[model samples]
Target chain A: MIDNLILGFQTALTPQNLLWCFVGVLAGTVIGLLPGLGSTTGVAVLLPLTLDFEPVTALIMLAGIYYGAQYGGTITSVLLSTPGEASSVVTTLDGYQMARRGRAGAALSIAAIGSFVAAIFSLILLMVLAPPFANFALKFGPVENLSIMILGLATIVSFSGESRIRGLAMASAGLLLATVGMDAATGTARFTFDNVNLLSGVPFVEVMIGLFAVGEVMYQIRVGAAAPIRTRFRELLITRSELRRSIGPIGRGSVLGFLLGCLPGSGSTLASFIAYGVEKRVSRNRSQLGQGAIEGVASPESANNAAANANFVPTLTLGIPGGGTTAVLLGAFTIYGLQPGPLLFQSQPKLVWGLLVSFFIGNVMLLVLNLPMAPIFAQMLRIPYAYLYPIILFTSFVGAYSIDNNMFSVWIVFVAGVAGYFMKLYDLPMAPLVLGLVIGPLFEKALTQTSALGDGDLLIVLSHPIALVVLALAVLLAAGPSLVRLLPRNTPDREREPAGV
Target chain B: MSTLIRIRGNGEATVYAMLALVGLAAAVSGAFYGVFVDGGRVGPGFLPLVAGGLTAVLCGWLALRGVHGRRSHPPGGPADGVEPHLAEDINPVDDATDDDVDISGRTRRERIHNLWKVFGLTLGAILLVQVVGFLAAFGALVFVISTWIERQPLLKSAVIAAAATGLIYGVFGLFLEIPLPGGLLGLGTEG
Candidate 1:
């Protein structure tokens, strides 16, 4: 492991790789500061640019964007009271209060420090756990893989907002969309409609660009933009006492966030919310929570960054994405002709290790980049949406058009964008759709493989202990919400915020 | 039935009904491609058929529930309309402002206008790109959207559009070597 780590660092430290990492995180920070754009859009829109780069470097840059956005979200959450990302929403609760009380600098500083600490902690945990998880996953056959994929899809549906029915429908829609091309098993056209473009199926990247980037741009156009709040800069140095107060919250939040992040369907947003809730209940300074408590900013900040980093575990080791951003990364993996799963660890150890090592360096870069530069990035909020939306639309068009150099792909993006807008309007979660699309082919492949292995017995899944257990868990997870609603309530539940990217 | 339909509301019921129809169509098409084969080999359409069937069933259930929910409500009492899970009041990334606007708040004309302005420009750009080339089409899109929709100054719009076009041309066309469509302008090599 040590030797691998050394090799990873050696690859990551190359001048070209390091340069792209810097550019990626820098771009990530800028995008993160913009209220309308999050890591998912940033990664999706920027993915095409990396098509010509080395696979490892491209992955590194994408990872940098992923984690860098975590740090960027804190700036607006603390200073403007508007979270740049959904995961940072909790930070705004107390973070804005701190800013209002003239401790904006302290709030921002603690968030940066806590995020740095937590990211490192999660990365360390990822290093230790991912290898063993990948090794264990290597033993999973088609039956188990199908079961695991079922579990993943079920978790995503269950956790996607309030309407499990709608979520399931969206997942089904995604799965239907995935079956649009020539069937790999039998060379038969399923839903090509005699169009040559449909013969290859929908380009996943174009779908991503359409749903996330173009849809967002259109939404922004309808809802006018707001001016960013300006706050006076103060010393960014955290006081010793504040640091002391944050230590426990940071430690607890990191572990909690990393664990939650590893779970399918529970992304950083939920992790931050849970971490903040935990801190409020247990902190010695609970009275100050929601009223400028430094711990308020610390805990969620740390948890979100930790969660963001920990999200990579399932993505890399199991080929399951926990959220939208990782889904884009998964698509990128396919684009690079590499399948991410247990085999990826062995087949492309250099790419995998290089990416992991880049996380270490990327976090350091984010820390160094964010501490002083956050205030500057916040100024980016003033870039008028008048200019921003046009740029976003143009870039989205280019991205879609670049995929097949065909106008058909571009048209798909526009159509998908309209569909995405309506889905959002109807409160349908987009993450599950993306998750279903990315996982659909895999699910189909696994199902067919399992059926073949079982020799036409549908109950073959039950014969495998692990597959049976996983399917059982999937059933429980899918039903858990309804079951909970039926149970007698002792106390009124707290209003849970909707999940976001 | 009239009361139930009234309570369910036309908009909500129609959306669900449309979804069911689409799902049914998907299922039919999928079945046409063969859902299963000999020796229990799952055909290409097997998963799609399942997905389509599930969608049809689930959406059909939702449509029924929408009407049933209205029927279950007491007369003269507030109808518990079938509400999809509304996202919380917190501002999302795309919507950073505090306005709580919804489609219901706008007149049909207003809604159509907004939709047309946004989608029209986008679709126009898509169609125009193949005719005039990407840069020219994109420039026109930016200018029209910024000036007409956003109501920015014409000069500012032009500058922004020009900058956007340049960036797209340089990055995607030149740097990445992606052969963007040149159309009539012939600025870009045919991809």
Candidate 2:
């Protein structure tokens, strides 16, 4: 393992790879600060540009973007009180308060420090656990695989938002959309409506660009951009006492973030929320929570970054994307002709290990970039949406068209954007749909293979102990919350907001 | 009829119910096109059938709940019945400040108008990209959006549009060689 780590660092430290890593993080921070552009959209819109690079370098850059965006989101949340990403929402609870009290510098500094600590912690866990987990996953058969996929879907639906039913419906819609192309079983075209483009299925990249990038632009235009409040950076350094108080919360948040992030469907947003709630309950100064407690700023910032990095585990090992951003990364893996599953470690050791190592370097780069530069990044909020959105629109169009060098995909982006706009307006979840789309083909194949192995006996799933246990857990995940609500206990924990991708 | 009308009156619930109906229709179409297959031999339509059916059932339930007015506020907001979709903060200090943008004050008609304008412009650009070229179509889009919807000065709009077009063309075309659509410009191959 030490040898592999050495090899990873050697590869990641190459001039070209390091340069791209810096560019990726820089671009990621810019996108993260931009309202409505989350990591998923940032990755999707920028994916085509990476196609011309070496696969390892490309993956390194993309991973940099993913975690860099986590740090980027904090700038807006702390300074302007406007969360740039869903996961940053919790940060705004106390972060904005700190900023208002002229402690923006302290809040931002602690956030950067906590993020650096948590990212390193999670990356360590990922390094130790990913290889063994992949080896364990290699033992699973079609039945077990299908059960696990079901479990993944169940977790996504359950944590998607206040409306589990709506989340499930969106997932279903995504599955239906995935089934649009030629069927693998019979070579029969389903839902193509006889269009040649439909023969290959809806292009997932175009869908992502449309739904996330284009849809966000349109939504922003309609809402009209607000002039951001500017905060002058007074103290870039956190006081020793403030740092001392944040240590425990940061530690707790790191562990909590990593665990939840490893779970399929549960993501950084949820991790941040749970971390904030826990900090409030257990902190020595609980009453000061919403009133700019430094621990409040520290915990969620650490947790979100940790969770963002930890999400890589399931994505790499099990081929189950932990959330929307990783789902897009999964798509990128497919685009690069590198299937991210248990075999990826064996087949593409350099790429996998190099990406892992690059993450370590990327976090260091982000901490350096964000600490003194957060105030500068906050100035990005002042860029008028009128001027900025048109550029986003143009890039989105070019991104969609460039994928296949055709206009058909561009049209798909337009339609998907419209659909996305309405979905957002109606408060329907988007992450579940993307998850379902990415997992649909795999789920279907696993189910069919399981059936074939079972000789068409549907009950065969019940006979496999592992599959049965996973399915049981899926059932429990789906029903446990509602069942618990029926009990005569204190009113349930606050209904969580829909998680951002 | 009255009960059905009442149910339809709930805007949020109606939308989900309509979506469920669409899913049910798709499920029926899928079933008609292929057999469900017996004895664990799943057919081509198996996934659609299951997914669509489940969507319909779940969405139907959501609609019913909405009709019953059982909709509960999400957890982050205060426990007050005020819909926290854009609710102000609970802290008096934060609430007293009026720095946040209040788009919620915009009338529904104005909001819809803005949405259509943006959507229409994007759709126009998509159609125009194939007819004129990427740069030209995009240039026109930026101009129209800035000048028309945003009501910027014509000269300013043109400058912004030109800069944007040049930037995109240079990056995707000159640097990456993406082979963007030439269309009428004939600068590159018609994609």
Error of 2 at A116 (Å): 0.9
Residue A436 in candidate 2, Cα distance off native in Å: 0.9
Task: List fnat per candidate, in order.
Answer: 0.42, 0.48
For candidate 2, write residues A289-402 as lDDT tens digits. 878899888998899899998899989998988888888889889899989999999999989999999999998999899888888888888776777888888888888777
- Please provide, for model 1 over A306-397, each residue's C-alpha lDDT reduced to its tens digit, 9 standing for 90 to 100: 88888888899988887778888998998999998988889998999999999989889988888886667777877777678778888888
Candidate 1 C-alpha lDDT tens digits along B144-181: 97888666899988988988888888898888888888
DockQ of each: 0.32, 0.39
TM-score (C-alpha) between model 2 and the true structure: 0.92
Worst 10 residues of 2 chain B by lDDT: B74-83
Estimate candidate 1's alpha-carbon lDDT, on a 0 to 1 scale: 0.77
Model 1 residue B59 CA deviation in Å: 3.1
